[model samples]
Target: MNPRLKHLVVALSLSLLAAVFTPAHSADTKKADAAAVVQLQQRMDAAEKHYRDAMLAEDEDAAATATTSALAEMKAVVDACTKQRGCAVDTMLTTYERLLKATPQFDDGMPAADEDPLDERDFTAANVPDTANAASLLSEDGQRFVKMVQFNPAVQAGIRRWLTDMRPSLMDSYENYRYMQAQMAPAFKQHGLPEALLFGIMAKESNGKVHVGSRAGAVGPLQFMPATGRRFGLGNDGSGFDTRYDPKASADAAAQYLSERMAQLNNSIELSLAGYNGGEGRALRVFRDTGGRSFWDPDVYNQFPAETKDYVPMVIAAAWLFLHPKEYGIRWPSVSSRPSTITLAQPASLYELTICLGNWGSRDGYLRALRNLNPRWAADDMLPAGTSLNATFRISWLYRFNCAHGQRMALAKQLMASNVQSALVRVGEPTPAGSPQVAVATPAPSAAAAVPERKPAKPVKARHYKVKRGDTMSEIVRKFDCDLGDLAQANKLRKPRYALKPGQSLKLEGCKG
Candidate 1:
């Protein structure tokens, strides 16, 4: 009986030990599974980081192709974990997705390319100024860096609305604003000027169109009436290089001039800008008469004149935009317009460069850039050699590589000789001009393309009339509120009847004082 009981107790004890050890083994297996998942995640994270870093490097284009590889690798990790381990790693996936979206987001929708071209290397380094000596070079060549900003929500929305109302052409106008700011702001700031001032000038001068000029002889981004431009050291470099129209150069002058006025006026940007637009002496005289009061003080401010009042507000508003682009709802461009100096030992015309654009497989982009980079070259001019282009761009390595060893010269030859008249071939279809089959062919008469010079914008003439009652004519003249025949005869109405309707309309074709 004792032997039977002892044997039973020993067997029960062994069974209990087996049960405990079995549960412990299962726990160890579960811990190992968790550890493996964590390890796989770490590996995936490392890969993601590598891709992320690569995306942030000296040349962003390198990441364009690598982007797909990184995405695939990440997806592989997620697939492996979800399928093999049944792991629910929502957080990891989100982090990876965000990295994918954010890596190449332009700085304020503009390239963060290093302003100090000398210091920049391949990828990962910020484009901020680094060296002390760069300032002298900056001053000499003049910095023409344009960084696009969100600006402010109000201004952006207003501009978008105004442009949308005008026409689709305004879409490019909006882009021009962004691009002009990018080209101008750097020089503006470098000279201790506010970026909004540029916007203000653009608003009054060209409505933000970079190519526009004033009939009063103002030209370029700021519409520097040629005399005023020369007074401010802005000139054509004696070769049709209208520096006033150069976003960088004009911005440089505008900033310096504005800064001087501001300092003279005791940091009053309003007064300073008023003087810049109207006349400094006039602004100062107005200030003196107002007992040196604040610009916003209605009593004296109103006396300054309507144009001044409107101008001051415009400057302030534009300045507000510079500081807060996103607030204005303005979406800046993804490209930077900072001036880059690539030495061309020889002069090269923009037209000649277009021909060599065959090297780039197309000249559309180069041709388009000419209006900004080399303003002197008419659209059709055979680029005379040795032209120093002030391109409104922070040219990347891609352009430099394309134009190595005077390759631009050959390109210029082609650009001059190539016909622009072939009715610009559709994109993706290579033009016969550059097609391998017809590479050496000369331009035919039909292919003779002329780069059209933008004609001076026609001035709009408005009619003035005095209110009159019951004045009707077979042809109603819209001036002086008189009979069409009487008014037309007064001016020189060529039309037998300058057809008119009854109302407050001009009674003559031309009303003179």
Candidate 2:
């Protein structure tokens, strides 16, 4: 318990006791006796303990549960206090507010509780969208989109996985998607594809994490391979920025790819998705060889690799869950994600922005949102003043209020400027007479003391390193503590994916070592 919270709680207890024994109380007025007061205090303390324990253990689900339980307990206490004639309800309400402030707002990583998992309507009604009366729940386009796909046991399994073990991932996906919906969803809508379908592919591909790069050379929110991405107008834009990492561009490309596949595969969403995961050439060959049979058919399904078999259903399942989250007891956190932009007030990095933003209206803060929106900028890169950044309306407001100029902003700047090297203690070193002394703990020598004359230092010469197998540009730069831009320029390497070959010698310029 926080010391302030403890003091507040004690004050609340005293106020309650005073209220209970007050002589000013009317004779007929109901008063909570000593025993009832003790029980209420115990409940409050127990709820707080449970919440603290869950948080300390980092059990996200348990913490969420405890938070809910604590809030409920506080509400019940407030209600009970209201009914008591002489109870200091204001003090109780203040205590509740303190508890609310004390509780940690866990991010989307925490899965919400699922209610009745045995609901027949969720699965049965899923088969037919029109008859399910989903019009009230979904858009006209959404309803039409759901009707295009058939639900089966495989999809049901996918749904089960999402609702159970993958619930946190699903929640994270939804949260990430919400911030990007304005940028990405319109591309799908223009292509006459469902937003849910776009979400499904993104969720399955990268869980809506924009900068994700796979071991197979696939990159971005939609996980596009370099060769394939180029085919769909996704690649480096000659500005060191990969368009494949751009949510809008990648979503547009995915929509176009899916549309092309649908046109060839008899308008089957499953077949189109299969073409996406498995090679398009293979899916096309399989479709023709199997006489254009359904994707679920044994011959057509077995034609794909095991990955595609899982991929198709999982994508569909994610899509279904996106459309029917409430049916599975998933109440997605409301996001104020209306699109807006903020021009930088001063030079600052994304890390500094994240720190200053302080999670005012969001659980996780604006780091992911900033990364997804501005894929061109690295988290630590300092953007020049007046540079416009893609952000939500809430984030823009937060930026104005908290990030512009404040103690928080100053703190964020200080934190970003901090270096791990400052904490390092060099061992087995006695400073040479002419060597520069670091200003850590050693006291400055007296001005009167004779200082040894030092020879002029030579200009730092450029160093070279041979690229080894499995070495990437990021790894090489980090290994030498080199400036990426400088190293790339020196080596005549392209931006974004700085393609390095084995045994290739790289000129290490502007490196610390």
Give the alpha carbon lDDT tens digit for every residue of 1-513 in model 1. 699999999999999999989899988888988888887788787778777565354443554446556766887777677764536678668856765543332233433333332222311132422221121222312222122122344334444444355333333433455434445656665765544456656655565555575546667767777776787899757654567767678877878777778777766766786787778888788787877776666765666677676655554444343333444444433444443444444444444444433322111344545565555544433333354554432332223434534355565555443333333454446667545433434544443356556889999666655434544332122222244335556544333113233454453454332
Candidate 2 regions exceeding 4 Å error are: 1-137, 424-508, 511-513
Give lDDT per model, in order.
0.52, 0.76
Instruction: Write down the RMSD of all candidates, one decimal each.
Output: 20.5, 15.6
Per-residue lDDT of model 2, residues 301-406, tens digit only: 9889999999999999988877776677676665656566889999887889999887755778889999999888777666889999988655775676567755
* Clashing residue pair totals per candidate (backbone < 3 A): 57, 0
